[model samples]
Target: MTPLSPDDYTAIRLSLQVATSATIIALPLGFAAAYLLAFSEIRGKAIIEGIINLPLVLPPVVVGYLLLLLFGRNGWIGKLLNHFGISVIFSLKGAVIASAIVGFPLLVRSIRIGMESIDKQYIHASRTLGASWWDTLFSITIPLCYRATLAGMTLMFARSLGEFGATIILAGNIPGVTQTIPLAIYQYTSTPGGDQMALSLCIVSIGLSFIVLLLSEAANRKMARN
Candidate 1:
């Protein structure tokens, strides 16, 4: 096997960075979406949920293309960001956005399952005791779903790590810039005599994913014990 190059190392680092960033950026939004789906009584919920979970069913390439259109120079968002000197297309920010959008449904699904499992009696009791909605949410709802939230984050992080098509389209596989593990592997596989490098990155990707799962399970167990 060929020794990993500096660019490979950078790809590894960037993969982790992008995964972490996407997970962090998506966490709050995921939680809110879950909370809405689980507890809210708004009309058109089915429509809202369908939109939220659309990426899960759509081809990643399609998602990427849609994102590209939304963030292209002629796109409204792109124009607005350009005025502020912020770029999303073909950049690290674009990579994170792509990952977040792709992985968000998993996060929301996990958290929603957790939230739905919580005993409604407790929530009712909190409300009966004069707790505000926010107070009940913070004091009861979120605590009960902590494990689910962690699981969601774990799933999202792993998904982010493996994201390829959407990321390639939005972030462009620029070495040491937006290139991640999957992107680097894609590059290596296309280049002659680069099988060894691709294999090396695959091993790294597997190891990182394993570590994330282990840590998530450990945290869940610790929370259970507490």
Candidate 2:
């Protein structure tokens, strides 16, 4: 095994931290959006879904650029946040934001599928029994669709782990700050005598992804069996 440098270790740790943070932060939003897409009787549902799933179809670089526009110092939201002494551009928080944006579609899609899979009768019965949509969602939708939520979380986590384009664009790959596994790998590939290190990180990345995939499969099988 190729021995990792201190910076490599930091990259690995930061990747895990950033990925976990991004996925956790996006969970509630993903659930709400997925629920709306799956169950709501809203106009322009198709447009909402298209926008939600844009990241899946758009190039990563384009997504990164869009995030930069939204979070850059002169950007409206960025200007407001900056006035309060908070800045996302070129920071670890930017990395998290980038990851969340990039992985959001996957999160929403997974949960939406889970929500849609639930029988309509349950929702109807809850409504008939005087349960509000909120009550039905919390009691019936979330409980019965737990597996889909779990899958969505895992998928988002995995996607964030390998995030590169958006992270580097928004966070600038500062070592020990915003440098994640993918960024570190990019650096290795560009430097002289760094092939071995790059390969090591690649192996680590692949191992992590494969483990998540295996867990997802196991979860699906368990859900099916139940």
Candidate 3:
């Protein structure tokens, strides 16, 4: 448990890659989604929000199956991608996609809460100063909501790191490719005499999650004081 094996290290590395990739992919879209849900006056706002948040309530396995339907080689988007010699199914890219989908709701919700809590006075002032929507977004909205965005990203990162059901279904547990920490732990637990290995991975997972939470809190405190 103290020392990790090469395969375990690989799993950790893959997890980091998947989580980071997922966060990066979701960042801009998540912010846009949060902004829309918080400020938009569209008639279908609730419907859009529910669709965005479906992954949170739906089973992860179900989400994965849906993704497969959309991105499998024979599937619509997957066929287009395959025509270009790109592959997603059962690949690292698939793992990132799965993690991103599973963690998207958390990212959107956190930013939405932060944006909604912000005083509208600053926005009005920015508008009065002749700042355009894009300008205000960069100069006012984003700056004031930086802490929230960071917190959301951190939470989403943690979620992505722990993603299992969707990832296993879409990405598979192929070592050196899509075998993330959770998949590795599952594999170890299922094997005979592999309890010790599974336990070690579990501890590592707990430690990493705790560290991410602490870092998120520290960032919030720092931003609050600044």
Candidate 4:
């Protein structure tokens, strides 16, 4: 096997970092949205669902553009962040944000399905036992659907790892910095005699995706057994 160069290693590490960060940041929000859609009677639930899924259907470039408009140096939130000496545009942080936005729908959808599959009897029993709303959610609902939550997280991480268009548009492809595996692969393919590196990255991405699939299957099997 050909050893990867330092630049290639950096790209791999950065890709992992970006995807992990994206997954961590989005997980809670995804869970909350999923729970709300599954169990609540919130007003405008359909509108909330549409807004959550918007990034899935929108062009990646448009997502990036919207991110830039909302988080650019001079944009409202960006300007506020800048005052604190933080910036996301053209940075690894921006890549994380972009990936989270794109992967969010998948996370929410998986969790929603999980939540829907849960037996309502358990919740009702918990309520009858005098468990509070939050208590029932944490002790009953969430625990019962843990496998589904894991599946959602795995999918979100895999999706974030492969993110490209939004990453490039929002963060740019700066090697060893904002450049992730997909962005690096794109860069390699654009240069002469760089197919080898691109192919290597592609293989790594495929392996990662396969592992995620395996984990999801394992989770499903575990759920079925219970």
Candidate 5:
């Protein structure tokens, strides 16, 4: 049982920050994506869905490499961001972006599942009552899918906490900056006599994940009762 160093503490905090930020940032987009996929009858829907879920199938390192190419100085996005003096490579933003991308598919999938479970009768009833599309979405679709949305956020947050390969590649694992729990553990394991520290972080990660699961279940049960 090794005590955590200050850097370890920073990593813990950073992990929470990144996971929370990524989940919050992705929630609305995930919901919209889920809604579109679940209810839309547009052409090329399968292609859109496949593109959205690409991260889930691709290796994290590959995702990171592609991101790097897309955000490098010569990259189109990089050039655009540089116009505003904003940076992504080797920064906390990059870590958040990487985590968000890696965990996005899970969020979308969970919410989509939730959306699909809703009975069409409710939607039809809402429309029959003269509710507009936007009204139906906010008042009906969203309310019914609250549990799924929460589940997606939980999964994304947990996944973000464990993100490593893409984060390290895009964010460079800088201590007290882009370093997170997984990266910290990787760092410790790479150093001689650092096994204890790595194990300590691993324990912390397990605890965090367990807490997330418990909270998600509690929320779901409360939603069920309401």
Candidate 6:
């Protein structure tokens, strides 16, 4: 194995940061969406579901381009953010947004499944016992679905850590700023005599993914036991 360079370390760190930020920002939103889908007979539910899952089915490049259109400097929201001195494109923050979009569907799916598995009778009981809607959700629904939420977060983190197409398009791959592991690996592979570095990064990515899967399985088992 080649000795990892400072750049490689930076890349790994940035990847983790991006993944963590993405997962954190997306978690509450995912849970809310899952809950809505699971419990509500709201109008346009199918349309909302399709929109939530669109990122998973659409090409990553397409998603990235859409983000650029919606969040780029020249875009509507982007211009507003810029007026407030917040920039999204070509920055680490942009990477986080890109990663979140890419991982959103998986997070939503996992949480939705968990919510669906919850017994509606429990909710009814909680309400009959005079629990408020928010209280019931926090005390019962959230605790019961915690394991699945964690699993969803783990999967989203893993997916975000290895994201390339969206990150590259939205964040511009600036080293130490937005260059994540996958982008770094791609860069290494393109340089002369950089195969070892690329291999090392590839191994790191695989290791991260493996750990996420193991943790998810463990969480599932624990939930099952309880």
For all candidates in order, the CA lDDT equals 0.95, 0.92, 0.94, 0.91, 0.95, 0.92
Better of 3 and 4 by TM-score: 3
For residues 134-176, write the lDDT of model 2, one tens digit per residue.
8988999898888888889998999999999888888998999
- Superior by TM-score: candidate 1 or candidate 6: 1
- Across 1-226, the per-residue lDDT of candidate 5 in tens digits comes to 8999999999999999999999999998898899899999999999999999999999999999888888878888989999999999999999999999999999999999999999989999999999999999999999999998999999999999999989988899899999999999999999999999999999999999999999999999999999
* Model 1: how far residue 108 lies from native, Å: 0.4
Whole-model lDDT, model 6: 0.92
Candidate 6 stretches greater than 4 Å from native: none
Query: What are the root-mean-square deviations of the candidates from the true structure over C-alphas?
Result: 0.9, 1.6, 1.0, 1.6, 0.8, 1.2
Model 2 scores a TM of: 0.94
TM-score of candidate 5 relative to the true fold: 0.98
> In each prediction, how many residue pairs overlap at the backbone (N, C-alpha, C within less than 3 A)?
0, 0, 0, 0, 0, 0
| Backbone clashes counted, model 3 | 0
| Pairs in clash, predicted candidate 3 | none
TM-score of every model versus the real structure: 0.98, 0.94, 0.97, 0.94, 0.98, 0.96
Query: Candidate 4 — which pairs collide?
Result: none
Q: Model 2: which residue pairs collide?
A: none
lDDT for model 5? 0.95
Candidate 6 TM-score to native: 0.96
For model 6, give the 10-residue run with minimal summed lDDT.
Answer: 215-224
By summed lDDT, the worst window of 10 consecutive residues in model 1 runs over 1-10
lDDT of 2 at 168: 88
Q: What is candidate 6's lDDT per residue for 1-226, written digit by digit as tens? A: 8888998899989998999999999999999999999999999999999999999999998899999998988999899999999999999999999999999999999999999999999999999999999999999999988888988999899999889988899899899999999999999899999999999989988988888789778878978898
Error of 1 at 134 (Å): 1.6
Candidate 3 residue-wise lDDT, 171-208, digit = tens: 99998889999999999899998889999999999998
lDDT of 5 at 46: 96
- Candidate 2 runs further than 4 Å off: 219-226
